[model samples]
Target: MADALSQFEHSIYIGSYMSGILYGINLVMYFLTLQGLLRKTNHNSPKSRRFFAIYSTILLLLITIDVAVNAVWGELMWIEGRNGPGGVPGFIATQTAAWYQTMGSTAVVIMIFMGDALLLYRLFVIYGSKYIVIAFPVLAYLAGLSLAIIELVIAGKPGGNFFHGKSINFGTPYYTITISLNIIITLLIVSRLLKLGKAVSRALGRDSAKMYTSVAAMLVESAAPYSAVGVMFLIPYAMGNPIAISFGQVWAKIACLAPQLIVLRVVTGRAWGREVITQAQSNVEFLSNGRPVVHASGIELQSHGTTTLGDAATEKWNSSTKSLGSS
Candidate 1:
């Protein structure tokens, strides 16, 4: 019994420390990206700036709550003898512990959902603002959100862990929805970009199309890291590996960081590569007797023959619009 207790305690410590380190890294990256985004965003575009402002505010709030919850839970359950005196006999699921645990878990869930929503919105814009294209992803997202709320209720009711045993049933499908959503969105974006890049190469030259391919590659590369981390969390969790605890601790940090990096890359013009096109392709028009007429190729980006220049600051907006015809 003592040996088993020692192993369990050791696992908790390792997991806690790992989570702390990852959270620290997350803070650093978040701040850096926030600074870059603020600097590069067009001051004239109130809509874009306001959206980012709200995004950053919510992200900071969620992470702050997550960190605070973890600290309090650690202190109360681990250091302050909630697991019985001297931290032995493992966590005794009390009402207070349940609340703290549920709060932390919920915060992470909300943060991840926010990140996924941003990705879905990007997908909407990338696919020419077609609502029907994202209908399935939207349904899946709503289903996942409902499950997350259910899990929160369960966790708040004096559970040992939210992802254990019967709870695993809900948790499994929840993660599946999230993973599937991300994979579908990324795959669609990559496929479209590749197809467009090939077409551009044929029309222009290999050099011109290279930018499109590079941005596509960058998208895949940025998404791959956290997707792998999420899978690692899922596999160990399913198999009941103790290290799953460690992975779970770091999961939220990586979740928020993934999308932030993508936004930072695009907003900073890094996604555009070294090319400097002075004008937007969507800005191009043919003049007929002093009246502007839409260029045929640029018409794909329009919504009923109307285009807005205010969307230039966004990640998907810049990439999709510019790649279509920036010549």
Candidate 2:
């Protein structure tokens, strides 16, 4: 039991250290994302900008509260409560259902939910808003949400422990379903982007297709790191390992970071939005002269005896190329 207590304390200490680093990184990224969204030169609609601004702000606040709560809990466990009852381990055991701990757990849940919701929204948009494609995912998300709620309720009860008894029973399945959802959605989004990239390549050249097919674009669009961290946490967690907490801490921060990265792309006019497919399919035309013409964002590209593109098209194309190149 002493050894176990030591392991738990070490796990929390390491997890907290990593969480702090991630939170700092997240803070920097949040500000950058916000700046991009609010830039006057950004072409996204005001409504879109406003929505993302609020979305990012809420995520920031939740993560801030989460980090702060964890810090307080750590102090209480290692210092204030260390000499009470049976020492630090006993204090932890007794306070498993404490309000601060519950709040931290709740913040993590909200972050996961928001991340999964964003993934679903991206999947919906990528598939051209076809509700049929997302029917099962939506059901799975709802089920996960229900389980999370139940698990939280169980953990918040008197003498409750998050990693034991009924709490673990519900928590295991809740995490399994939610993490599985992220993995499935990431694969789907990446598959769709790859397919579209192939078609764009054939029509508009590899350079143009790079915008959709690039590694960075796929990583951001699919939130691959978020899914990766979830898998890392879920595996050990399911096996009842103490180290799971460390991965879980990183997973929570990545949940926020992933969406912020996507939002940054969106605000910069580089993300694959709802109109990407439509624009790719409808914008390319073959003239009677056997020359290809491309239209994008109201700008025209004509391949005469010599290829010529309008200023707006050239600028947009150049910007995309630069973004991909830098990435």
Candidate 3:
């Protein structure tokens, strides 16, 4: 049993390290895509660029710091056991390392909070600021935050052991709340897109309607991975399994990359606007002077009209749900 437990811990450590590497790779992808967008096109205004830059940079920094903390703590607790605090002759069996509980868990919680908040903002924008639509998510967010604080306090207590003690109770439910929050937010966003797609389908045609559904699919593709990973993280831990951090450690990367992928897609002009249809789809031959034209019951819609940078920024930051293709 002891040997099995040791192997389980080892596996979790390896998994966490592997996930950290994946996070680094995704971070590079995000940077490269953002660079290409800014260099190749003027779709994002200066202010918009600044906002994205700040947001991306902060996430990168958080991941970097968290990974570093995990690396150092793993080395101290697992590797150079005789040279560290947990090395006091079988104390490792009795007491979990403090760093994983305090600093490591805190980093994980912070990343989860940021990711959820950003998704919440996106949902708010897409739903045309209907507070009622976001009421449940907002409540979940608050509850999650409160539980996270409780976890932090428990983990930070003098000589507290998060994984093997009563503190694990707080951590488990915290993960549950985070998972539930993400699921709720994801469903809300997807439902909105579906409704929008049906409306667009009625206005335009069957073919054009697929784009909106595609958007919904895109959202699910982005949002689902991290939530799934969060569930992976929670289940093992709740069952007193040692390999839970394998899933927990990598979710930060997924959460950060998902929204950036959407932004990158929109800026690249392959999605997010009707012009993509004019360029990519041949059947949407409704083009006037090389611009996509939309006819909704004989009402002409100019889908490619230029909006000022200020207008674009306003639409994004002010959370306006006005359709760019309509009027």
Candidate 4:
């Protein structure tokens, strides 16, 4: 029992430290993302800026509360309650159903929901807002949400424990469903991006395709790190390993961080947005004169039989080139 308690203590300490570091990184990303959204030079619609600003702010607040709760809980377990009753382990065990613990858990679960919802939204947009494409994912998301609610309720009961008893029955399935949803959405989004990348490449050039097909773009769009960490936590957690605690902490922070990164990409116009396909495909046209006419973002150019690309078309192409290169 002493050895087990020592391991739990070490695991939570490591998890807490890692969570703190992640929270710091999240703060930096949050500010940068917000700045990008609110920048005067950003040509995004007011609706887009408003939506991202609100969502990012909410995410920041939830993560901040989660981090603060964890700090207080750690202090109560290791510092103030160190010598009380059965010591640190006993204090932690007794506090599992405490309000602060529940608050932290609730914050993490909400963040997870937000992240998954964002992925589903991306999938919908990438697929041209087709309801059919997102039907199953939406169902899975609702199921996961139900399971998470049940798990939270169970954990808030008197003498409740997250890793033991009835909580595991719901918690395991919740994690499984949530992680599966993320994987499915990631695959769908990546496949769509790849297909579009090929079309764009054929129409423009490989450099232009980088906007959608680059490694960084795919990783951010797919929220791969969020799903990866979730898998890491789920495996160990299902195996009853104390190390699961550490991974869980990191996973919670990643839930917010991943979406923030995506928002950053969106605000900066590097993400795969609506109408990208149309924009790319409509850029090049072959005329009767056997010469290629260029169109960019609604600016159309006719080249008669000459090879000279007009100033307007050239400017638009250069702007697109800069955007692609930066992305």
Q: Write the per-residue lDDT of candidate 2 for residues 1-327, one digit (tens) a residue.
A: 777777778888999999999999889988988788666677666677778889899999999988999899899989999789988878888998998889989998998899889889889888888999899999999999999999999999999987777988999999999999999999999998886665455455677667677998999899999999999999988887788888988899898889888877777767886555655445454567645564554434444332344567546555443232111
| Residue runs of model 3 more than 4 Å from their true location after superposition | 1-4, 82-101, 199-212, 215-217, 220-222, 266-327
User: Which segments of candidate 2 are over 4 A away from where they belong?
Assistant: 283-327
Q: Superposing every Cα of model 3 onto the true structure, what RMSD results?
A: 8.1
Give the TM-score comparing model 4 with the true structure, all chains together.
0.87
Give RMSD (Å) of candidate 1 vs. truth.
Answer: 8.7
Candidate 1 accuracy as TM-score: 0.72
lDDT of 3 by residue, 186-277 (tens): 77767666655544443345564464467555564337676777787788879877677566566756766665655554444333343322
| Candidate ranking (TM-score, best to worst) | 2, 4, 3, 1
Q: Write the per-residue lDDT of candidate 1 for residues 1-327, one digit (tens) a residue.
A: 566456545665776776677667667766775676566442224455456556766776787788777677667666676447545355543433376667778889998898888777766655656799899999999998988787677656654456555666777788777877777777776665554454343333466446545765546433656666777777876776656666776777777767666555544444432122222324334345323344344323334443333333233434543332111
Worst 10 residues of 3 by lDDT: 318-327
Encode model 4's per-residue lDDT on 1-327: one tens digit a residue: 777677777878999999999999989998997888667777677777788889999999999999998889889988999899988877977997998889989999999999898899888878877899999999999999999999999999989988778998998999999999998998898887776665555454567468777878888999988888999999988877777888999999999999999888878877777656444445654556545554444343334332333456446644553242112
Report residue 121 deviation for candidate 1 (angstroms): 1.1
lDDT (C-alpha, whole model) for all candidates:
0.61, 0.81, 0.60, 0.80
lDDT at position 2, candidate 1: 69
Q: How high is each candidate's TM-score?
A: 0.72, 0.87, 0.73, 0.87
Residue 319, candidate 1: alpha-carbon lDDT: 54
**Which is superior by TM-score, 1 or 4?**
4
